[model samples]
Target chain A: MKLDRRKFLNMLLGIGGIGGIVSIIYPIVSFLNPPKSAEPKVNSLKAGLNSDFPENTSKILKFGRKPVILIKTGKDQYKALSASCTHLDCIVQYKQDTKQIWCACHNGLYDLNGRNVSGPPPKPLEEYDVKLIKEEIVVTKLG
Target chain B: MKKISNKLINWIDERYDLTPVRNLLQHKKVPMHRHSVWYYMGGVTLFLFMVQLFTGILLLLYYRPGEDSAFESVRFIVTEVKFGWLIRNVHSWSANLLVFFAFIHMFSVFFSKAYEKPRELTWVTGFIILVFTLAFGFSGYLLPWNELAFFATKVGTDIVGVLPLVGEPLKVLLRGGEDVTGATLSRFFGIHVAILPAIFSFFLALHLIFIQRQGMHEPEKFKNLPEEKKKYIPFFPDFALKDLLLWVVVFNILIFLALYFPWELGNKADAFAPAPKGIRPEWYFMFMFQSLKFLPPHLWFIEGELFGVIAFGLIGLVWMLIPYIKIKNRQNWKYQPLTILGVVAVVFIFIMTILGYIL
Candidate 1:
């Protein structure tokens, strides 16, 4: 059957509208459908020197793409805690005087060992295996 | 003989007295009110939306929203990818500006009574578009996996939990769990980058179509009403074209601001950070957040959170329902409480926003 002019135009407009919506939605759906966990390159992230980390202070160290907070307890001993807030994942700040990693965004506080102390933090800071290697602080991320 | 007929057909088509086309092509009249410059706020909003679309696409090239790759991908985009920081900033800053000017545009139209009579539907549709615009902001907040976005989403979605019966379910659906997690980020990403824009564009197109069909509203000013109002431009070649020119100017301003005061990317969200006191939202939202702060726990036998949910939901419903409110008697505008309340609400929001920043 031959389509009338108005009908054809309406059909085209309908097609365009549906197409626009689909075009907008398809990528977002794919993106939303559980992103493949980036192949973890997390093979023993290396951080800073144990002796260089000041007492009572936790330094934000880069271990690959992860944040490892390195705090000095003794001359050769260092503590490694993840700097991610357990609430909404805001960057947790390390206050030297308090000996705690704090998330200022939502009032989440964690002990130097990454245990949640108070406020809205639902989880403790994840700890990493930390050691001193020839004056360099080594951090291997643990659960 | 066929060639001759074809030439005749072409000639007739060309000379079909296409005066309608010629008139549209010619430059037409535009409103020359001194306050017409304020009209650029709407144009600014439109321009920023274009910027958002472009920059969002650029961001899409690298952003990973999920449990594992979210933080890592964000790091790569900011520090590793070439000019990725600029793309991220442009998108971020434009989103802020887009929401800002949309509010300004809505109120400008509201206060001027541009929503009266034939323009009522336009106002209503525009309001829906505004809602979706904010929803866009809310969803996009979690994508960066930073402290502010992370905790802010927690506080935000928790607010949804204050709704009476459906509250918990709403929160769960929004976050995709009992808490903000990889599921939450992915859900928000879907809404931000896809769903909200789809809804907004639909309403926005309808708004424009209504404006074109009914034409811009004439002033109710009896004595001071300008005679040239009736003689103004058509949407196709005149007003819409003017809007384009204004959009170009606004686009340049956005670029300048983006270049000069590039958006600061805060620290990537770490789930273990201590929450900050007086954690606030984007300035436009600060008023409502502040409003919630003002409510007492026992207001009308309910907690402040529940009260806030009902109050805001009511306000939104009234805004959407304003078009159908009939003021019968042929001429006098209805003294609807919603109007005064809307103005008060806008002013209150603005004042509270400033106060939030200060206090």
Candidate 2:
């Protein structure tokens, strides 16, 4: 079939428009998802020995891209939560005297259970599961 | 399918009038001539701006705006992230290209005397866009938070501080503190990503609307030619198709540059560290940088740096008010003060830029 001038131009425009959209979207998708090399491995990791984390003491450990607060309230009783505040992602520190997780930014607070107890935090700190394997203490994401 | 499409068109037309727009496109004509290639300069600049926008947003996703993380994050984006290298380099290169094309467009408009009468506001808006483009460049330069960028920003802000009374306040406002620290990074990042784009988009829309309302300006010679001697092409299909072809070509060039010369992630800035040697502004700012360097410490006890700054301000003022300065004259290009001044300014920029590199 022979294409007329209008039809030909319309076909060209349709093709160009599709190409234009695809060109734009490809970069955005690549940017958002990022390549595997760029993404930090955010899986479970060994925090330390159970003996290192004693009663009434808390320690901050690097867990992939975020900092995790590992606390031992009692013997063999371990709790782990992300140290980033839910409000602004600032690194939260454990106030030993208050026994609460505190974000210096905006005075945000989280309870021992990782719940947003007060201040500007809109959500609870992400909790992680802690387990003891022989002498090693391991932290993993909570499902 | 065709009938349903036609019915949908009819449905939309009932609510809003589309016929006038269709008619406008159908009847619109672009004058075709030897200098018609310059007309595509605006379209190319627009395309480059779009490229900058896309790559800019992509970079924004991964960019961390802080004194501590800014440099590291950009390094990670360029070196660690997949295709982050391409996105970043394309963004940088396109920014340079956008400024380059804008100058070409301004010159083409100047030589053709397209800014004459009726189109003065259009010219003003175009000038505003050019300024916005330069502002985008300056603000975005410091986002990388590298050694060169750090010193360059310090030098840039120092230049701003030379202004009479508002100098110190404006410097503080831009730097956000006593010096170029983390505060400066945050301020520049916000201005680069959010503030400048918002302001530039407003002027860009006005510039575009003016162009559409007035149509493309024909050179004086073309306008003076007999109607029967002139040639024209429809704006919708013919001219637009050519514009698309040029855009495709430009896209290829942009990608090629991005792939071949991936942008570098220089050393992270340390405020306490000594300013490194050979630090300079981007190529576009080299002229001003060189000019400032060329000045003596004092000229007859009056500060030479301050004198240079004042001179630059006066030149900028004259540039912005060119249309008003020549408001009485139109239709002739020979011996025009604006034209002569334009040529001299271009020459000054070229000479200074070369000297900036050499000296």
Candidate 3:
């Protein structure tokens, strides 16, 4: 069957219009529901025993290069925050007296709870789910 | 009362003549032939300014610009205010983009003869707007009061101190003291929110007015009009709509990049931590910052800093004066080698900016 010039042109326009719409709409929808960044809740994996963490201090424990700020708040209770600033990913340090995470790059100060206090930082440090399993500390990266 | 209404209507009708403004602005019709995407740099700059203004007001709702309240206020916004973090990011990024596009727009206009005859005032006002924009960046950069802000301001303002004779006074004027502390933050905040915006709006209105009065500069071929030809179109339904559409596209693109990549802010500045190894100025200043590297300690006994400053001032002066620089038929810049220099200059700036970041 021979396609007429008008029909061919209509077909071309229709294809082009659909392509344009998809190109614009798909990215927007993908942006709105971006791929999940955090690990799914799972059996908490242990980092090390209580003796490894000293009193009134935190250490950056590496779980597959996903750095966790493990703070031994009390003898039994431990608090954890991501070791990076949410603003730009500069390493954050644990503040002992105030019980906050501090970043040196921008003077970004974060409380133990991972809340941003000051500077050009836009977001708070991410907190991790720190569960004491048996005698070991298991810190899972939290969203 | 009836006579008064008639007289008022007549007065309003006479002064508010839409035709002349529309005739001159004629917007899209005026430009006639802007084939490249780069031609929209000015419009893009305008678009980012709108973004900055909108998001800035949103930030102002929670931001308290002072020593004691500043840090806490930012904390409150991040955790307490709904979607405040997102708004702040958009505002900061948009401010940077505004400066970026303004530079591109200014240079493009220079090489294209867009700042030519009857448009010199437009050029001057545009230059002033650029200055106000730098002021906006300087002021806004200090508002958060973190360590980076503290040290960056200290180093940045100290550079001003290297000037001969006026250096000390200028630094004091900027910081309100020997160091950049609370006073400097407050002053910068005031300028960012109030004075700079007011001045920018004044110049922006004038710039738009002149752009309207002169329309767009044509390539040499189209400078002369044929007898009785009226090819110009209305700005509102036609060009303004197109501008708005393109603006929406740019906004969406910027927001997407901001969210997905999420430009990193440095860790909270630790006033105690040694300054970051290689703190540098924002992208727009990298050229001048890098330019300083090439200069000698002193230009024939003149302080290097002073001579460097004067030298840049001269470059800017030349840039602004380009439209007045006469050339043969000069209309077709597409083939001109001098135009090639403008492109090279822009590329060099980009390379230096990236190098500054990497180094």
DockQ comparisons of all candidates to the true complex: 0.14, 0.01, 0.02
Best by TM-score: 2
Selected candidate, larger DockQ, 2 vs 3: 3
Off by over 4 Å in 2: A1-143, B1-5, B327-334
Model 2 agreement with the true structure over B137-215: per-residue lDDT tens digits: 9989999999778777876776677678988777777877656778888888988988899999999999998888889
After superposition on all CA atoms, how large is the RMSD of candidate 3?
A: 22.7
lDDT of 3: 0.71
The TM-score that candidate 3 achieves is: 0.63
Q: What share of the true interface contacts does each candidate keep?
A: 0.25, 0.00, 0.03
Q: In model 1, what lDDT does residue A78 have?
A: 75
Per-model CA lDDT versus the true structure: 0.73, 0.82, 0.71
Writing each residue's lDDT as its tens digit, candidate 1 over B267-327 gives 7766544455556787767887667656654466776667777888897887777767664
Better of 1 and 3 by TM-score: 1
